[model samples]
Target: MANIYKILQELPNLSFEEIFLLQEKVTKEADFRSKELLKDVENTILACPQCGSKDFIKWCKYKETQRFKCKDCNSTFLPTTGSSVHWLKKPKLFLRFCVSMFSGNVCSLKTQSKEFGISPSTAFEWRHKALIALGQESPIFQGVTEMDDIWFRYSQKGRKGLKYSRKRGRSSHKGDNDFVSKVLMSKERGGELDISLIKIGRLDKSSIEQRLSGKFADTSVLVSDKHPSILSFAKSENLKHETFKSEQHGKKDIHVQTVNNLAASFKADVNHVLRGVSTKYLQNYANWFGVKEKYKGLKDKVKTIIKDCFSNNKAWDMFMNTELLYKDFILKKSKRTYRCPTVRYRKHQNWNFENAKRGTYI
Candidate 1:
């Protein structure tokens, strides 16, 4: 300690010009270190995204980014090309944005835009791009799994020519006003979860069966509410099924409370955190929640998200595909609402009671 103190004391004090030079040198060293970290990320790119060729050669440099040439295709590409952040305007701010995302704070696009000085639209795009990486599907559920469907009303926000109704809750199933969208959720006990926004016209036995086929093993047990469609699904699939009446709550070993709780939490997140997200992006929001639930206890979630983001080539493709717009949220015609025959049958049965109440029955 005395020798170190003596060495420090013997060093000459720097003049203002010398201090400025030293500061510049330190800043350059810091910049170099940051570049080294980013280069490590770039090293993960092996094959050419265009031709799937492993042959790579140093093509050129552009604005401190290394460019590569594919030997087979003779195409040039940047290291960031075909990746999730491929046309990112400010690469240096990416880490900061990611840090904010994983910081367990309420990070809306508006909030992020204000904090990072980026346009709200850019923040929205970047946020979804990152979420697309996290939205990869999990392996099928196994063991005792709980399954249920959650419904969200179709939103007509920001749309023209739609009559604005003051109804703020689930609508009566009597008319077109009762239109609702569905999302199927399944969770394996102590395992992964699967949540998919259903694009089917009806949540009938046939639709449930189709979605459940090949998703469960023969040894798996299914637990769900007393929906007749679900009951029929269990019978046809020949899997052991447990049915619970949701109205009869607090029952042990017979309820789909796990998946129900998951649905509740998911809805809460959509309502509170995202502040009532549009139905167009609800699937992505659900997927983001699923991934968050999957990686709940991880200590280094930021690193994990970044690793997954880079490893997901499909997400990169989806991000780059400009034709895939948010307006095209419904992938198929099946998403359109159709009147349920069961509801029509019930309404017909209720006609007699209405006529009797009105003293119009002969």
Candidate 2:
């Protein structure tokens, strides 16, 4: 039995085929008594978030669906209750498989449904819920942050037409003229990033200011290109801001390049794997991609994270801590400092954004 447990822990990075192999192996070797014993020891202690009741029992009357019922609260719900998975129909095991498949840009939801014996709608629900949960999991990136914007077309290939073609009958229109604005922000040290959706307009003073209002009220410095939007906002707010407008300095450490590369990789993956996602869910998908990147290859990272999330399961508390994480990381470190074309915009500038500069000084 101990050997069986050890073997289960050592299961390889699971593929669709590998999952079947494990299913077969586990089923053949796992007697009802052994399975019951394992469940009794491991799964017997889930708590109800709403009522804080431990008097709960696993009731899987439907065979395919798993739910927990609490005698104390007289409530029954699936594993997704109060979670991003609240309304999902895919099994929990399959949901984990979907997360693993997100290693690259696109996931074939149709193929996944067929392969896993789940309905397409169920697969879609799992994908959507997983992506949203990923967004909910991004750590508030802190320490010397950098931000910039990049443009993206909706389709992989631009509309069917030559760039210089001059056809009289409705010349050419790129696939639906859809575009996306990517606001890419990253922290120093570990390259942890906070990627967000933006309107299809100039990433200007108001844009920077709005994002800063929530996260940068306590920021130190901000860095960017010679873009006036970032520069003027820093000036108006009396926050330290710098730029890398020169050729040599741009070669050394430009956040624009960093952000572009990140966006490009994301675009490439989306194009190849997921094909193209709907714009409505783009933010959620992008956030999911960002969190995966941030936590890539940390041994047992997902398992550890899920354990912590379950241990501290309060919605309000989770939101409060999430805000703090964002403020400390994303808000404060916009113009991260290195030393190429150095500019120290702090020290002399006042920290207040609303008040007059003199109000804080003389």
> Best TM-score goes to which candidate?
1
Candidate 1 structure quality by residue, lDDT tens digits, 236-257: 8787898866677557777888
Estimate, for each residue in 1-362, the C-alpha lDDT of model 2 and write its tens digit.
48968877777767889889879886766445333332332352467755668888877644444667888988886544544333334435543554455544456777878767778866765565455444432234345556666554322121233344323322144432323334445444355676665433345576555455435434445667776776787688775665786564556554466666777777776655666654335555676667667777776555433432222233222222332332232233322211122112433222222221111100
TM-score for candidate 2 = 0.56
Candidate 1, which segments miss by more than 4 Å at Cα?
1-48, 51-80, 158-178, 204-212, 232-238, 247-250, 320-362
Candidate 2: segments with Cα more than 4 A from true spot: 1-79, 87-90, 102-105, 137-142, 154-180, 189-191, 214-220, 252-255, 304-362
Q: Indicate the TM-score of model 1.
A: 0.69
The 0-to-1 C-alpha lDDT of every candidate, in the order given, reads 0.65, 0.50
